[model samples]
Target chain A: MNDLGWIDAALTAARPQAVSALLRYFRDLDTAEEAFQEACLRALKTWPQNGPPRDPAAWLIMVGRNAALDEARRKKKQTELPEDDVLSDLDDAESALAERLDGAHYRDDILRLLFICCHPDLPAVQQIALALRIVSGLSVKEIARAFLVSESAMEQRITRAKRRVAAADVPFEAPGAPERAERLGAVAAMIYLLFNEGYSASGGSVQVRVPLCEEAIRLARLLLRLFPAEPEIMGLAALLLLQHARAKARLDGEGNIVLLEDQDRGLWDRELIAEGLALLEKALRHQRPGPYQVQAAIAGVHAHAAQPEDTDWAEIEQLYGALERHQPSPVVTLNRAVAVSKVRGPAAALAMIEPLAQPLAGYFHYFGVKGWLLKELGRADEARTAFDRAIALANTPAEAEQIRQHLDRLKEGAQRKSGRGSAHPAQS
Target chain B: MLYAILCYHDEAEVGSWPKEKDDAVLAKRALVTDKLAAKGRLGPVVRLMPTTAATTVRAGREPLVIDGPFAETKEQLLGFYIVDCASLAEAIEAAKGMVKDGGGAMEIRPLRLFRPGTTAGALAAESVAP
Candidate 1:
């Protein structure tokens, strides 16, 4: 790899450890961030000449901590600035620090940093924005583009989040087992939220926000490293991989939404599917089926199907049934109705979701499914009304367009029948 | 390390309960506190009045006092417990022991330690000197 490429990879790999350690020393977000930046600048200048450090994280931590201290001393006028040779000399100290960080200190520091970003006091949006900024090291502008918000608004959101985190006074100590479990749950939820933000990108903008999905997958892999034996973590990672493998066929070339049944299965990434299936198998063998594991199992069924008709709808329905019992929600039932339509018929599917209307009144998928069932039953007028509601509640332009196409089909059927009736008027 | 377990609950639901039911719930919490005290993990336990009796003051040139909690949410802060433990895990166990069945939520936050000369405004010149 080129020098810049190597430097970039090293920095990305080192950020979690180096920044976590710096945050420990400074006890403040802005100060820790400033120190990390200075270290990065020094790396850009010195790495090309001195060659990469044996432990990049250790090198960054030592240099960043000293730089911040130097700035502090300079502000007080108590000591002169260090000579260039002294500032850059980190061979012995970096090795010692690296040795110390290899112990339990490494995992705790990174996990604590992640927990702070997803602290309960912050809203979900702020939690996501903060994690993207601090953990993933995305620039504010880059994060703004991914969320489809303006730069200034995203900046304010991040600033406010940082202020709240500092005020909240998160602990610097390693969490105990129970607390680790709680924090792990929080982190998993945050990662899922991040993936959804990318997955649900609306209108013609599906490709613009794909980086969020990749980042979430990356963080999930990191979590798996920390808790390798935890089945749910494995399940979570597998679920994201299985779903993301279909990104290529999720939308057509014209940026329109494509239903899974109609999508070209050839476009799916087999490598990711294989990895997901392996993880799901291992997780299921653990005999602890959580919501994520059940969902991954369902996705695994889809991945194993080579053709659309080959999909095992019966197993999917059972998995959804398990999911409903595990974490009951109206949305789960709505999804199960689709499987029911395949296994049974449109009548049973319609009956299944008829009771969900009151609870899912504003839900777009509710109306979409209702419209499809109504259309299948030859109740065109009711289906048209349902489609109108679905369009009104559509989250993105692509989703709205998908419903509009269905409406057009109904319109054509009506026009054909009316034209036939007029041509037979003399016989009548 | 000292951790604060802040308990939040639906105020309306709690307020409508009978006095006997409230006392019974409090009795269960007291049992948990007694257990923690035996282990030397318990600290101060404080229960605040309802949000109806709360006030907020915004600092500025002139302070603005709002007559409710800082923000309106589904759950309101009803009480808190301070627990001293070796690590966050112990503190969480203590908090979980006290939580009632069907309770709303508990937020665990660590309290900052007070050191003499670590203020952001004050430069730690002596410590920084090479």
Candidate 2:
């Protein structure tokens, strides 16, 4: 079919691969993106009647590079071109890029994956913004609108992000075979970070940037296609899909954070959940439990629960224990405590987190969980104090508001038992 | 008349859609396919992977091998449906039913040549209610 829609889809699917390859060639984000555009223009003029090339990305990459070079040569005709040595510092970088890109298993080009993943320190939000703008080939205005920022402000933000990427040391040495695992890990983390940035639990609709989440999922799928057998890659893809399945249900009409138990399960996307569950099953079958697998297993547990009351808290606690073993952060332990409270009692979970106070002192989720545990124990005054801290530390107004609602409920409960001074007696 | 309805759409736009949206589109299309299948008129329906995975072997001086789809055109030949319809009007109606949501191209052409193909469905189900 020579339909424009078909052509558009072909160009869109090939964009990241084509542009990323061009970026590696040109060593400039703007130049690569511009070249990709020029190449698309040519493809439009020729592809319809001619039928699609065997590989769209390889086609676009070859065409874009030539078009960019032709334009560059024309523009610099009067001026001297870059000395071949300057642009072709290929002795080390060529091998390194090849090693990394090859590990991703691209069929057409060996050194054509992504430059953005190599720039590691762009901060979460900026990393995502840069990826969307450069590698994803989204317009500055479109990115700004996605992030709910002004167009010019977004333009400056992207420029700054690009400058930071430009400043980072270009990698040279090809990583060893063992380092291939680490290489894929970095790229996977980058994609997950992008998803989390788009999946902020608060600030309502304003904070939930749909494009970022979608883009991250897309990247994860691309990564999975390369290393389909690698359990962790499957888990990474599954985790993003599983988490994103509930994107619409995670926030309320007011944009307040809705905990899993309270979320409208009907709002969840069954298709994504099914895909995620299938991938997670495949990952578990590999029996190579890693951090991503552990986390995805946790999400799988949530998705598998038909109702909040049906959740297997014991299984969840075990998964959290597994996660803590893999990652071993106080945050994981804090998450574990939620399950602990459900399986055992509030006192046991409270004891579990008591030592974590020093480590999770300023974290919002920590206090929120602690406050809920305290309220369950009928330690109303302490619960109120913890909630106050949670509100103060919350990431967004919606989060703060959620804690405020909790505090209000606590006050209402205390008022109902007016004369009971500071506590409640045991049921026994 | 036996017809091959070729499906085509912009890859980028479809790829960008959230998983839930993609599922909804499939769910709607199932409504159309069920009726066709019930009548024993539906054939194999397939959704091709991204064009990157495609390999085209151009039969030339030495049968040249290329990297992507055979025809790098605007929209892609994403998938196809085979239907046994009484007339072109019936086939067009089937094409329209398949794309009820209305964003892709479905080119319906009468098959000049024929072969027995593997059936994806048993085609023994009762009527698919509207």
Candidate 3:
């Protein structure tokens, strides 16, 4: 629909692999990042007219590498730098560049780059942030928004990350099993974080940030290909797929958070459900489950349900119990409380999470869950207070609105019980 | 066939190496390196100075000189290895077992092959191919 139709498609298709390859070549995050940007600049100028090349990833990698190198050289000649237009016209050399960099060379460069980004030295946050910024080509502002950090802070974080990699001089080679295993956890964690950023959107924006989810899924698939028999990796990929399947029903028409039990089952993406289900089945066949696989299996059960009532709440609760065994945390307990409510009523669920209050005091979801449980227990006063706290801690406007809805419902219920008119104006 | 086992550590990661932990780490590294040398895999093991001794240069501009590392952060390159091995997989497998002295960190990368008559593209292809 836009002027540069084919070019856009080509860039979209090639970007992940191309950027992955460039990252391998440069080893430095900034260098790889700058190279990809340079490639895009050239593509915008050239691909509109001469058309995309035979292999877009290869084309981009080759041209991007040359452009990056040229820029490096040009920096050396900065005072006598060539005219801007002449330097930019290098975009026209796509075919020659592709001819020079083709086939197997292309594949390894990218694989190496992906491997490097997963270096065991970086923390999970830095690893994911670096991959998103360097490999997926997200801007600092965009990444910062996803992380709820300031742009300058995120920029500093990424800059520091790149410097660390450079100082480490992390190699550009496919590591063996032991090394791969250590790095794999980091890579899998990064991909999952990428998907979560997309999945957790508060639904206020018109654009759903679906591309990030798609990119994460694509990277997960690519990673699984690299390590086909790793059970945890299989679990990680399946988990994302299953979770992503429910994207459609997560938000309501007014963009409020729709609890899973309240979602319209028919609206869920069946194709994604089918793929996710198939993947979970395959992962289970490994007969060696990890936390991610167990979580995916739980998601699978929810996805298979035709209606909220049909959901196998007991089974879901059991899976959450297992997940806790595998990776214990208050968050897992908080999630299990929902399923506990379904199986054993609100009182049992309340008992389960109350012990968690001290640790989870500042957590929005914890208070939100507490508010919902208290409301279900006919404890309106306590519920309103919890909802007020939840609203105060809300990460987005939609979250605040969701808590307000609970408060409004509680007020309406109280008015009906007393046979008296409501005193306060209700939020929609 | 020489492998460089480089140690790595993230500055902000929880749980630094304690004294007993440092002793255990050194013991493990010594054990692994001895095992490698026993099997004729170890070439030379040397720990690099911290990133404080590092310098970086792009293509130009007086190398944009700075004090210490280009970026200031907690993670640093601790050390490395040069070992003889038949293949990359073997080298990397050995490298993974190499830990930081005093609980620092390490990483392993096969030296990029810079053969005569081969273009950078050809070498890049061979090194990078999946």
The true-versus-predicted C-alpha distance at residue B119 of model 3, in Å, is 56
Tens digits of lDDT, candidate 2, A183-260:
677777778888877887333336566677888888777666545567888789789888888888877888766767
lDDT against the true structure, each candidate: 0.75, 0.71, 0.66
Task: Report i-RMS for every model.
Answer: 28.4, 9.5, 23.3
Cα lDDT tens digits for candidate 3, A1-428: 12443354456546667776666556556666678778888988877677555556666778888888788667758767555543453444335455444544544554555556666788767777878776666688988877767999999999888777777765556566576566677667778877876776543443245656777876776566445556677677777877777777777888776767566777776656665665666667668889989988888787777766677989999999999999999989998988888788889999999999999999888888888887777788898888899989877787787778778778767645422212111111
Per-candidate RMSD vs. true structure?
23.3, 8.3, 21.3
**Deviating ranges (above 4 Å) for candidate 3:** A1-4, A34-54, A66-129, A139-161, A202-208, A415-428, B1-130
TM-score result, candidate 2: 0.76
Query: lDDT at A231 for candidate 1?
Result: 77
In candidate 1, what are the lDDT values of residues B75-112, reduced to their tens digit?
67988887777898887787777664334468999978
Evaluation by TM-score, superior candidate among 1 and 2 = 2
Pick by lDDT: 1 or 3, better one: 1
- Per-candidate TM-scores read 0.70, 0.76, 0.62
lDDT of 3 at A187: 68
